[model samples]
Target: MTGAMDKVGTTGGRKRRAGVVAALLCLVVAVLSSAILVSPGPAAAQQRPRTILDMLFGNGLDRGQPYRISPRYRITDPETPERRPARRTTRKAKPQNPAPKAAATAPDQTAAKPAVAAKKEDAKTILVVGDFLAASLANGLKDAYEDNPMVVVKAAANGSSGLVRQDHYDWSTQLAPLIEANDPAVLVMMIGSNDRQPFYGTDASLAVRSPEWNAEYQRRVDEIADIAAKQKVPLVWVGAPPFKFDRMSEDMVYFNDLYRQAAQRVSGEYVDVWEGFVDENDSFIYSGPSVDGQTVQLRNSDGITMTDAGNDKLAFFARKAIDRYVAADQTSEAPAPGARIDLPPIAGAATAVRSPPVSLDDPSLDGGEALLGGGSRAAGIDFEPSPRDKLVLIGRGTGHVDGRADDFAWNDKSSAVASDDKPVAFRGSIDLQKVRKEQGIKPPQEMPSILDAIMDDWSQDNSQAAGGAAQK
Candidate 1:
């Protein structure tokens, strides 16, 4: 009994030892597998071993840890002190600031600027006069002639002045002095924006647009034009553009007509700027095509004042008249004649056949009173006219051509059939039998039914079998 008990005890000890060995082997295998997965390469393996948790979810260094990059992978940056390369020098380096170095290497500022042309001593002056609108017009004219040294624009405009408020600021009194002082080649006037108010005469105050007020306003406009006329300066009256307000735009229309007559009386050119500020429907627009043909904001937020683009457009219409006057002045002083020299003619120059200049008003330019294709038909050479000639020239319909949808003429024979030598069948809801009969086509014989054909075949086989049995 003692020996058996000792044997069981030894066996139990051997089992425990085997279990411990198996557990150790599994632990070693697990550790080696984890290390293999966590390690990136041989280089990474040489560095400090990372924890399993660290390998799974990145190291705390990425989350603002105070760890500096290793010197092996550190890039040299001047901004970073630790990353900057150390330079070996015999003497101490001087303090460096890039600002002074950049300044020293910079190009000369004066040399980069373009040279501007100087204005001529006898340059033609364009005197612009009127209210606030005229002030805007002056600004536009200045920009227009900014590059032209021979033209100078002078603004003698009173923003609050108009023909109606003569007592406050009379254009009749102010205009003559301005023309005399400037000695302008062209006198441009763009007012009436402030003239919509009531007119005050010597006796009583007249309502705006009234017959008495209109007459008085006309006289005032005439007076201003007379001043420019007496000065021998060419007058250019720029009409008021449409306003944001409908009633104000209507008033401008009436004012423009009066300005037109006044300008006409003095033989001055009247520039109508109404179409520039309005849409196709003649309605006021705050934003529209600019002088460059690009869409841009033209009016101020208040709607009454003009923006830069609006001012430029206003100048555009008035610039034509001013340019004409300036051109005339320039051309008036003709240059001295120079000696003429003729060149030798070429050996083989083709002589151009020059036709006499045709008058635009001449009626015979476009084949005269005769319609197109209606000229006299060629004699003896018989040919049918084209559809266009038939319909247009003769004012007649294109006659029916057989087989076409428009052909309604019914005949025994078809044109298509005659050409192809085959009977053409008509499609649609037409009776096929009638068409076939008209074309003289015989109807096909009726086909036998399936059961009748089977019965006929059976009877022929039975007769052949009976004839063979009788012969046997």
Candidate 2:
């Protein structure tokens, strides 16, 4: 009996070890999947560098600028004559949209306020760089925004590009001039489709410099975002859209998260338009039927690049921000000449609700929104500890309830959860209901707000001491 008992104890210990091992593996996989969701594979420039998949699909942008495209008369350098921006495209008025119904006598109409000149708008221009699909967006902007004199939008797209090893040799240097010359008001960037071609070094740690896939992708986002920051240009990094991705899809996911982190670091913005096209299963099929009584073909015949309709959709959102701004005030400084859009603070913009009961087999929640006050409050992030945990600490989503208008923070990080390695603190709203739901635990209703309870008890104790002292 003693021998049998010893064996049982040993077996139980082994089982516990196995369970922990399994949990750790699951954590790693979950994080890895989430990482790949946004990042793309990499490529170095040498060949034509076009991916049939991307060619048919797209480079992930369906929106664009003030004068999205302006391939007008050839422009010569004002000083050097050799160095010029958009040599082939000078500032020229494009056609008016849905041409305003003419009542004749239109020559006198423009006398109103001396219509603004598109060329002069270049002084406050915004720059956008992306993959080939973004070319249409650039053109669309030129067509739609030629009338807005307050802003000029310039763009350059390289067909198959990576953040680290760009297939198009000229993009980096071509784009650098704008930062050097204009120091733009805003910047819109979206690239990273062909990076999955693999360019890593022998050692994992040396991947980025060595063109290793992972490091290279990070380098791309960081390098781009950092450059924009240095230029004092607000940057908006558009996330890659879903495609009929096989191997590259996973890489795209990883890169997307990196974009978000980079954006937060620089107070930039991340636009995730992946959902506008992808279906419930995350598949990319822009065919089958039509929507809006028109052909439902959202994608080009090639299956990747967007149709004209898709570009309009993407442009609509981007333009709305621009439209909203000018209306706010005449005195408000126009967006920084090269400034990226200034969006609401994203960090600490989370809810207090936690996710409800879920099965052990679920992995979907790992990369999604944290539950907050309006509904479930807590979130169980299956954390996978990294070496960074011992170095710079960080945390995930932080948010609050709706009527919290009076309680917005002095800073965005005020409501953020502390790093997993540290004790969680709170200066902003805390959703107890959300917390309980997330931890799979519940608290009794009689428990007052943690803050209220602590202060009330302390006050009572202090008052009692004062009374006793007086009596003495």
Candidate 3:
């Protein structure tokens, strides 16, 4: 009995020892697995962008292949009054005509209208909206024909902010003050940087290929155009600049095309800056000194923004556009087909001699671009247009070393941090409540001067515009 008991005890002791060994082995295996987990591969998971505005301002957006789509409709959402599902059904199309050859084309689709109805004059002064690109481009504009006195640079309204927020939020409210301070004849919009993603909204989404996003985007374009119409300010649509390393760079291309489409829809002009930045392969490349110098790395250290060479090219295109449009506008008193009646020309130092070869009937321009300016940079600002952190970098700010310039002279307004707010305005600011008091045009609210509300807001403390500042 003693021997059996002793044997049992020995076996139990052995079992206990084995169990301890098994636990230690498990611990060793767990430690090895953890070590492997800690060391990731050199190719880290690319980060997605923060704000829609960040696509331009923030760096390192995911470089996922962008899905291409037609820019005819906007992918942006509306600003205020959350979108109720689209209730209005499409109107039936009257498909009768085969071609207009029989009717002599009915007054030429692109011909200028009578002076009383359509504004054909070249815009002397212009205002811009959305992102630092507009501000930087506006700052860089030069009087191309100095002696002519016909061309001039006037007021500019621009900042960081995105299209999504500008349209959805009350960012458009910021334009009131700009209108009050300086009402330009032409309004240039180079938006789309700030809003392409979710900002100040429930959804944290990337705005590429998302149908839900496109609907909202369209609303924003509509609102912008509506305001321009109300103000009688001929709009010039400036497209977004190109950048490498930005995942949304592909998405930006999609958005840029849409801007062009919106311009046509509203009888405004569209300026495409993308073509200039892209390579022969049509791929985006920030110029570099390496063997792949032409490879599209046109971004700064941060993948989102642009380089100096890029901004200068943009400036040149915009300058040419301003010159082209202004020349046409200043011409005759006659109006265009889809334009409003002309108001008296502002008392400037005599209008410029019109540029010949400029088609009066059809500018033939979807805003033609001249890739002139190059090789200028201001400090952190690049001559190229790329996304900065919370700021889409476009033009070179006022002062920087001479070598940085790529083409045109550029400047930066954001010496400090970029404002989260971009300048935007909806229809008229006049008291609509009071304006509708009487019949046609006889309301107490002093005929809504599209300029009044914008002017008013420009001077007020627009902390609400930046989004973060407003929420706090």
Candidate 4:
């Protein structure tokens, strides 16, 4: 019996030891699981790892029971269907009549305003003709009026051409057709550089400074002037500029004078480009004042053709006359955009308010009421001419006769007859007697003509040439 009790005690002790070992093993596992959960996991494992405790107690736990839910995490009672308001099924009453529909689409009757205003007036055409100089002038004028909507500049200049070269180009024949075709408001003509050469007259080939040459050249000039006059187109004739060569410059001066005379005869204005391209001493200059008053190179190395600045300056001179004659006529009190035109007020009509004129005198008139004087003379009374006012004839005979004492061929104020009763000398030093002797011609008291002056210069140049040749 004691031995049996000892065996039973041994078994009981073994069972207690096993329970204790199992309890120690569970505590060690719980500590290891808590440490693993508290510490950081492997970087590769983004998700929570399946723990041993979770696997053991996952199905056994009653986590959804009321006692298990914490006060902070507890869900409120679900909403009852009786507490919510029910939707209405019956529809509201419809209106008796619908609002009237807008009127049907119709075509617009009122005229729409123009997208862009039409031009008030056609652009005035300007026809330019001559040699290369005229071409340059045209270019400069075009640039000057580029922004102006009223001006149209046309270039019709032929290079290395002139009135003297009819075989090459006939201006008299060509100009009429050009005028008819273009119908230019203004005609600008410049020539005579190539005209320094000999010309062929109707009868024969004439010398450079001969009488026949002058007559023939004058006739050709008149023909061109007549063409412009027939069309009633205002002419602006530009004269030749002074050249670097003495002989050439002298010839140009003569040509300029002839051009001036011809222009005046035809009621045209002559533009003397000589002074503009000359120095203080009246000599050829390659550089001069431009249109903007800047000192710039004016001529090419050839000494005849013009630079851009030179061309602008040339056009500047011609532009003045163009403005006065061509553009001035178009200047009137035209109504501006949105401006009202003045008209007579009618009876029982609302009087239109208008700004008073800037000046009491009419701007269009020369002197307004001061000159009109109630449709009569303003300054003085009219003087009537009697039968004796007829022009008195200087010569007694109807045929060739000498002038009387009272007859002076020209006005007394002319410089042609000097204070000393002798003709005025030429502009610079070239003694008249010396010139006459060089040419084997007789000296005269009166001033020499353009032809005579040119002949004298040519003769002096020839003598110098002969002397230079003899010395060589």
Candidate 5:
């Protein structure tokens, strides 16, 4: 029974020893897992450990160093949705009316307001009369003098009226009334754009551009000028510019000629705007250099009407004549014709002495008889004519040099008749050897040819080989 008890105790001690070994292995495994979990990544692996305890614990030394965690590794709180930015919607509300918007955006308010403010009570009126083109000219003139309070542009134009359509709108009877009403300081007229039709009469109608038609047109134009002259108003007749149609432009040219004659006859000025609208070849153009020198469209798409820029250019040509009259009215008053003034008496007139007149043909007037440099020289000096003087006065030339391009003398023949004089020696050749010796130039050494150089190399190699064999 004692032996049995010893065996059982030995078995129990063995079981306890196995349990302790298993517990030690489990502790070692737990320590290894904790070290791996606390270790830094490869990037932080280069940092040194602060202490041996830190190395064992796998805590890398990051003291006093910046540590940034990547956003992918950052933990976000699920309860904080308000921290995110809200998205913006793209929907917009449409307006009910567009006209008010367009009216609010109307351009050139600064320019429009000043023009209205500049029209003073004492401003001088510039009366413009004609067809639709004259209406455009009026607008351009208004723009030209918008800032000048002293000048005012007024339009009395009839769009469908012309000299040919007297029955429709007669300018001869209507102009006198306009002049009296406006009492303008200057009268500007530009007609003939709509006058290319036949003139209807009581018995027979005159065809367009016919001799009878031209005579009647000139008569009507003359009558308009006469009315202005009678009213004592300054007239400025602006010529018609070229049109898109070739035939229409030709008619305008002829009309401009008549307008020029009539305006000149009345002692008035003519403004020719033809060259301004045409190109270098005198052909009609749609676009040209504007007043600011920038290229802009001058004519509308129809090619008959003018754009805003075109109207400004038309007024540019007529502005000078208009300004002259406006300036004349503003000029200071001259002295009255009957006014008289006392004049200062002439001084030192009675005792003044006069010198006798000299004749132009007298040589003594120039202080000598002979010409300059032709007077007598010193007694011992000799006077010889220079080569230039010989060539100029005697028509002779000096001798030419030999072998020159101008020397036309034959090589085998004498230049002058043979005389009993000795022949001249030729001295053109030179001795190169004597020149080289005097200059201390040495002769160059000759170099070996390709074949001779190869033979010399082979000979040297064979002699070396034979000496090596004897030494062996």
Candidate 6:
């Protein structure tokens, strides 16, 4: 009984201690709750010391300004209200400048407009764009205009570029930024070398040299041309040259046709480079006349790209068009065709005069004929036959007739020895036979034919036959 009483006593003491401890814990919780309720809001809390997490989240952004959505509400100090400049009580006066005389006469001169004055740009920028060919073209153009301060040649070419492959590089998108940045007066372009290949469309690939492909390619070209038009820059589209391969050259020709059509649609200048690099038969040539008309290698060994000479030749076609647009002094009006211009005659020049003709019968034409006792030739009387008869038969009517001895009768003026045929000593005498005998040369005899000899032989044979028969 004593042991049970002691146990009960111990248990009661433990319960009492536990109740005291529980009462203490309740008081502590109540005190903590009251303190939390008395704490400030989030905005106030942000003003307190920050943690490493808060610092990492917005260490750079969270500077002196307080967190605000709108720029007007943003403040350097949370306690201070931002101050703004006071509204003007009176209007401020603008500074006055003297008006230009031109502006007075033409009110539009002072008016605002989008068109840029051409003279503002000291030099015309010739922006050349294309493939590798354009690099050569740019280089040639630079050399061509090296001495001219008014022209500046520049290049923005992309190698292996073309209108057929917009996916590779879209010229329409590229030209906007290009023309904007360059602000060129003239835009020269010579692509299509890399375009003849098959065109890969969205749904399907178009075959090379196909009508559909050509149409799409031309559309791309038109897009590029339109960019220049929008920029108000004159575009000089250069045609592709004839390539080494016959099919490639033919495709280039078609491409040139499309370029020409697109250029015309946009009112752009189309430069024909095909003719300059082709022969009379329109075949591709590796060497041709360059810008200076010197014959040089125009194409590379690959036949696709242009050499230095080739590029110059290609640029030459476009140069004139570019010059026309870029040169402010160039006049579009041509002089009237076939207009006669009278120039002052040369000084001290004599007028042409006609002199009378001196005939062969004239004594003046005969040098010393009177001193030599020679008579002048008769002009009206013609002793010789017609020139036609003399040419037809040489020495005609000179031969003597066989039967008549007097066929060629001589006049009394003809002595035995004619004045022409006489010896020097007997020129006025008539002893010509003695001179002939002294010379010991026989006169010419008649030419004998074999027929006479044959007849004589036949008669002799007939006589011999008759004599033989009589003897028998």
TM-score for all models, in order of appearance: 0.49, 0.40, 0.39, 0.47, 0.48, 0.44
Which tens-of-lDDT digit does each residue in 5-64 have in candidate 6? 999999999999999999988976775565455554556656777656335333223334
What lDDT is reached at residue 93 by model 2?
82
* Per-residue lDDT of candidate 3, residues 312-337 (tens digit): 55566675566555653334445678
Q: Candidate 6 has what TM-score?
A: 0.44
Please report the candidate that would top lDDT against the real structure: 5
- Model 4 earns a TM-score of 0.47
How far is each candidate from the true structure, as Cα RMSD in Å? 27.6, 40.2, 40.7, 30.0, 33.1, 25.4
Q: Tell me the whole-model lDDT of each prediction, alpha carbons only.
A: 0.77, 0.58, 0.56, 0.73, 0.78, 0.70
lDDT of 4 by residue, 1-472 (tens): 9999999999999999999999989997887676556654344233566578545543122223222245655332235444444554899887899777666655555546423322236778889999988898998888766655567788899988898889999999999889989988889998888888788658778898789888888888888888888889989998888877899999888888888887788899898877889999998999988877789999999998889998888887788667645553233556789998887542211222463444321243333325321344336543332222323434222222223343334455444443333434433475655554577543468988999999999999999999999999
Positional deviation of residue 234's Cα in model 6 after best superposition, in angstroms: 0.9
| TM-score between model 1 and native | 0.49
Which is the winner by TM-score between candidate 2 and candidate 3?
2
Candidate 3 ranges beyond 4 A from true positions = 1-123, 143-148, 154-158, 166-171, 199-209, 288-299, 303-308, 327-472
Q: Candidate 3 local accuracy as lDDT?
A: 0.56
**Evaluated with TM-score, which candidate comes out highest?**
1
Looking at candidate 2, the ten consecutive residues that score lowest on lDDT are: 60-69
lDDT tens digits, residue span 112-223, model 5: 7533534667779999999999999999998877776678889999999999888899999999999999999999999999999998989999999899989988898899
Pick by TM-score: 1 or 6, better one? 1
Error of 6 at 31 (Å): 99
lDDT of 5: 0.78
Sorting all predicted structures by TM-score, with the top scorer first, yields: 1, 5, 4, 6, 2, 3
